[model samples]
Every structure is written in structure tokens, then in C-alpha cells.
Target: MKEMEQPVLSVRNLHKQYGSGCAACRDARRERLLKNYCPACGTVYACQDISFEVFGGEILGVVGESGSGKSTLMKCLYFDQEVSAGEAYLYAYQEGRQNIFAQSAQQKRYIQNHLMGKVYQNPLDGLRMNFSSLGNIGEKLIAAGHRHVGRMEARGRELLAHVNIPEYRVKEAPKSFSGGMQQRVQIAKALSNHPPLLLLDEVTTGLDLSVQASVLDLIKMIQRDFKISMVIVSHDFGVIRMLADRTMVMLDGRVIEHGLTDQVLEDPQHSYTQQLVQSLL
Candidate 1:
């Protein structure tokens, strides 16, 4: 019998909340909060028992409106924010035996540099505005322990070119680039370490329509060429439709619907999901 392939990333029962929970919101069965907020204790539950898996060479799309916890989920996965409780396993790290959320801070930094990459909603979050485009990629390489300047520059140039950044602009700071170009540079930087998993948080949110299409196309190309698993968070169904093989819809910090992208779009089971799909039509 052929063995089932291990998932590249597995997240289970993940939870992140701002402020400690009180009796009013702590009990799962009895708690009734206002859209993931504990009115009584003033706690905001950012992610609630979130769970999902990403297999090799596939993109998993997380779609939700603002405050749905999708972005927060991404942050938790990338270790930008500490998870209140949960287990996340990555195949590339310790053969998926260790729960990443439980790892020490130093170990988490290793995972961030070598096992996974992230492109933030704001390029400023991912790239140093004052640094050149190549320097940004070099920074990730350096974090991954690369020291040879010649080799690092070669890699930086290769990734930048792969993302369609012109050779002439490699030395330019990201702040000098347009919104779309800055995102492209960020993508190049994220790919510099050749990580197995990538997390993208609304990578195309603020771009012009034409630029958004171009960035989306570039993302598709990257997934196809690199074969890296991706977890992309977006409020735009269009972006999700274009990139995701499977989709998870979040609402009030909970996953209300999950399925193949086509299936979820065609037969949405949750009321919020149905409304979201209807908005597209």
C-alpha cells in the first residue's frame, strides 16, 4: 500500500486572544460573545480553535472580512504573535514531530528563517524601506546562515529576476518602487531562503486593479515553479479563486466553512459564506 504523504504544515486547535479571558468568555459551551469579543471581560479572541493543513505544492486560501482573524491566524503561523494555545507541525522541522508553538524563541527563529517565509499585507512590514531590493533578499539569506557575499548576491539577483524585477532596479530601495513593485521585491525576498512553506497576508490588497492582476499572476507562477506550499489570507474572493486549491472561510475568529475552492464557491454551506459568494455575483 502506498503510504499517505505527510502534510507540509499542520495546525491544530490554534487559539490566540488579546487579554485574558474571564468566566463570561472562557467556557466554550456557555460563552456568548459579540463577534469574537468578550463584552464582559473586554477580551478579543483573535483565533478560535483554528485548524488546517497544507500539503506539498498547494496553496490554501483563507478568506474573510476585516476582524475575521484570518490575518491574525497568519501572524500566529509565522510567529509574529504568540499563540495562546495550539499545536502546529511542520514537516521540514524535526520531521513534524515537534509542535512549533511550543518551541523556544530561538527555535522559532530558526523555523522562520529556514522552514517558512512570509509576505505581509504591507510591504513595509516585510522589507526595510531604506535597503536596496537585493539587500532585502540578502537579509533573509543572512538569517538562514549564508555568509558568502558573492553567492548571496547571485541568489538575490536570480530571485529578483524570477519575480520580474529589472536588473537596473536591483540596487534601488523598496521605498522608491511602486506598490506592485515593492510587493514583487517582497516576494523575491520571501523566496530567498527556499523555504518549504510560505504565508502571504493580503499581498495584493492595496494595488491598482491592473497591478493586482499582475501580482496575482506572479504568485501563480511562483507556486507553479517553486512547488512551495502557501497559506494566503485575503478578503478578496477573486484572489482566492485565482490562487487557492482549497479554501477556508473565517468569521468571528472561527472557520465557518472549508472545502475545495470550487466546491465552496459553488455550494457554500454557511450563511456568511453564502453571502460572500453572492457578493461576487
Candidate 2:
């Protein structure tokens, strides 16, 4: 059999816990910490033995209700939060290597600069409210050291245009735009560096159906146009069903079901996944 291509992102035996009491818990903290505790129950094990993989050119949808640790998992992947344990390997195309929990500041900076783009649920969180859309996009590009490649001002307007926002709005602050338009700006900012992996945390949340569809469509376009790997964390099954090639149903920070979108939607084996499917229907 032909060997499978290495995953763009590989997470193995991944575990994250909150409390300090349990024996297993102590061993599970990947980053050295003096203490731990179950943030919810005060018992321990906020995340337990979680594992998953994402390949290039794949849209991996992660679904679970609120507090099910959907965002936590994404946070870990994005390096927004440190993992308690397990391997989180990011294959850096620019560096030509697999980075399993990059330790050095330089490595982290390199990855942040050129290897990934992250989008969050809240536009305000990802975008700068004080700056114009052009400023927002240009600022990130400048920070990434892309100032020498092109005129930052021209590039910013081009990105705004690419996202279908009017050229006039490029000079307006994020607060001046409507929610959906603000989201478009966020998407543009995320794409500033053209990272191969895009991590989105409920990018369509709080939008109406029509708006949600449009945003999702934009994301699809980005994935296709850039051939980027995307991991979308959301509870909306309809969104996942429409946008994702494969899906992973997560509960309590563990993957309960994972397969091609059609198979999981049509023949869900896990009770949790079935419930989720039924709820969405």
C-alpha cells in the first residue's frame, strides 16, 4: 500500500487538564506547571486523552455544544493556549519540517508570521476597532515583515476588495461596518500572510442564515483559492454539512465520531453524534 502523506497538523494523545490532584493528571501536563484543577468541577481533567489529525487541502469541521471544549481544542491548535500534554505537530511548509509543540520563541514567531492564519467568532476580538479596515490589514502585514514585498496601503485596499468590501469602507473603522462586513474584514486580515492553515472558531456565529451562508461561502472560496487546510470549530451542523469535507463530533474534549461528512451525517454510529444530527435536523 502507498504510504499516506504526512498530516498538515497532527495531534496525538492530546490531553489538557485543570486540577492538580490526580496521578494521571500530573503526568498529563505537557508544559510544566506547579498546579492544576478542574475548572468546572474542581475534580481535574478539563480535556482528556484527545487526539486528531488534519491533512492538507481538507476542511475539518469540529462540532460540539457550548462548554464541550470545542474552542479549547482550537485554542491549543492555534497556540492561543498551552496544552497540558500530548503532541501537537504543525507541519510548517515554509520551514519544511514538523514542529511538535514548538519550544523556541523564534520558531513560534516564524509560525505566527508565515505559517497560519486564525479567525475567531467575534469580529471585534480579531479586528482592531480603532483602525480602518485598511489599517487593520496593513498593520498585520507590516508586523509580519511584509512591508518590503509591496506597498502596504495598496495591498490593504486590494485585500478589502478581494473580500468584496467596498473600496470606500477600507478607510472606515471596524465599528463603522455592519457585522457581516466586519467579518469580511476579519477574513481579509486573516489571509494577509496567505498561511496554509486557517483556524476558524465559529466565524459565522450570531449571523442570520443568509449572512451565515455568505460568510461560509467566502471561507469556502478562500480554501479553494488558496488550497489551504482549514479547521472550523462550530456547533452548527448545517454550516458544517455545507462547508466541511470531513467532520469530527466532539464531546467533553474527546472525539466521539469522525469520518467523511456524508458518512457521519447519514450513518452516525455514536449516540452523541446521532443526537447532534437529530438536533440539527
Candidate 3:
């Protein structure tokens, strides 16, 4: 967290919308839209001028209610969804000089395969249900240009083991595993490329309380052990509190507050953020 150290991932003026915006919704500075939706043109601004930086080995948590654009932000960052407007720079890609959003399809694919990894909220979205856990991890390894089967298999086994997936179940497909196990496998696959940045979208949302705890613990462990910068999106303050080094609170597709986790939790400046912190009490 040194002032002179460059951020691992830097994003600026990120915006995403589902429909073409009208004059009423075009000028977001005026705040004319109703909760990110324009009545006249039916445009839904999922994210508006969202900006943030994640430093190396730091976890930046994004907490917001459903439809708050947090998940959309993650999708845009991971290239699962295209951004309407924005620029994202990764230190590991072109020395952070290139705007990732503007990269060519092939260049973007290279970034996705080698510089970043993402774990979707739904296991099905992140994993091939029919593929064995090792196969899933191997898929990522292959994309990263690992050609030797022996080396890839070794790396896959090491990652699965790191995520606490049983060796016996390495050959088992995620379809046969529990929700928690599937998530673990997804995480293992995401980590296969050893990407400097990892994007996780509501990873513990559907899990049981005990299962959520285990996954949270696993995340913390990964952060500590791998020292990879992460952007974790969740609606739960509890999850953010447990994992984030810094927190950003989003509302109506805008960032209302952001600071160190403790600062935001202890002295929430915005009313919406206050309500969120209160709900956690």
C-alpha cells in the first residue's frame, strides 16, 4: 500500500447500460434517472462512472444490494460483459499502459487467459459441469500455453489440493459435487493460471452459513498465500468485512462511499452506506 507503488488494476469512468440512453438519462451528473432507470427511453444504467484501483495483494470489496451494478462491474472487468464506456489497465498487461477494454479480441483473450481469472457466482457459469475437477483446471492451464500434460496435471493437482479438494475427487465432475465443493473447484480453476488479478462475483451468495464460512476462510487463505490482488463483489457487509482490505459501497449504479474497510464500517458517510452498516449490527 505504498504511495509510490503502482496499482495492480486501475479502472476509470467505467459505465455500462442495457439500452441506449436518452437526454434525460444521458447526463448522469444531473441525477435525472429513477434509480438507474430512465422512464422515457427505458435505458437501464447498470454502472455509471465507476472507478477504483486495486493494489497488489490487496482485496477491494464491492458491497451493494441487488441491481446496484456491483456484479455488472465485475462482469465488465472480466470481459464477460462489454462496457459501454471505460478504461481498465492491468500492470501485468503491457506494463499497465494499455486500456484493456480497448484491446483487440485476440489481445483481450490473451489478457483473460494469462493476466486475469474470474470465479462466477454460479458454479455452472464458471465450471464445465461434465468435466472432472482436474480437467477444469487443466483447461485454464492449456489456455495459458502450458503444453506438457504432466506439468499441467501436476499444477492442477497442486491447485486442487491447495483449495482443499480431495485427491480422490480430482477426477469427479463438479456436477456430482455439493454447492460448496463446486465453488471450491471453480476457485481452483480460476487460480490455475496464477493470474495477478482475480475477480469473484458473489461467490458465497447461495451457500449455507457453515459453507459460507468455509469459503470465506478459503478466500482469506488464498489472499494470504497467493498475494493476488482481488475484486470481490457481494451484497453482504459481513462478507466484505471478513475479506476486504478496502470497501466500496455502491447504490443506484454509483459509488456512494469508499475507504478502508474499518473506516467505511465505523463512519459511513452516506445514508445508504449507514443503512448497510446498521443492517450488519
Best-fitting candidate, scored by lDDT: 1
How well is each residue in 109-220 modelled by candidate 1, as lDDT tens digits? Answer: 9999998889999998999999999999999999989999999999999999999999999999999999999999999998898899999999999899999999999999
Candidate 1 accuracy as TM-score: 0.98
Model-by-model lDDT, in order? 0.93, 0.78, 0.93
Candidate 1 versus truth, CA RMSD in Å, comes to 1.4
TM-scores for all candidates: the values are: 0.98, 0.88, 0.98
TM-score of 3: 0.98
Per-residue accuracy of model 3 over 149-266 as CA lDDT, tens digit each: 9999999899999989999999999999999999999999988888999999999998999999999999999999999999999999999999999999999899999999999999
Question: Lowest-lDDT window of 10 residues in candidate 2?
Answer: 30-39
Better of 2 and 3 by lDDT: 3
Which has the better lDDT: candidate 1, or candidate 3? Answer: 1
Give the runs in model 3 whose Cα sits over 4 Å from its true position.
none
**Once model 2 is optimally superposed onto the true structure by TM-score, how far is the C-alpha of residue 214 displaced, in angstroms?**
1.0
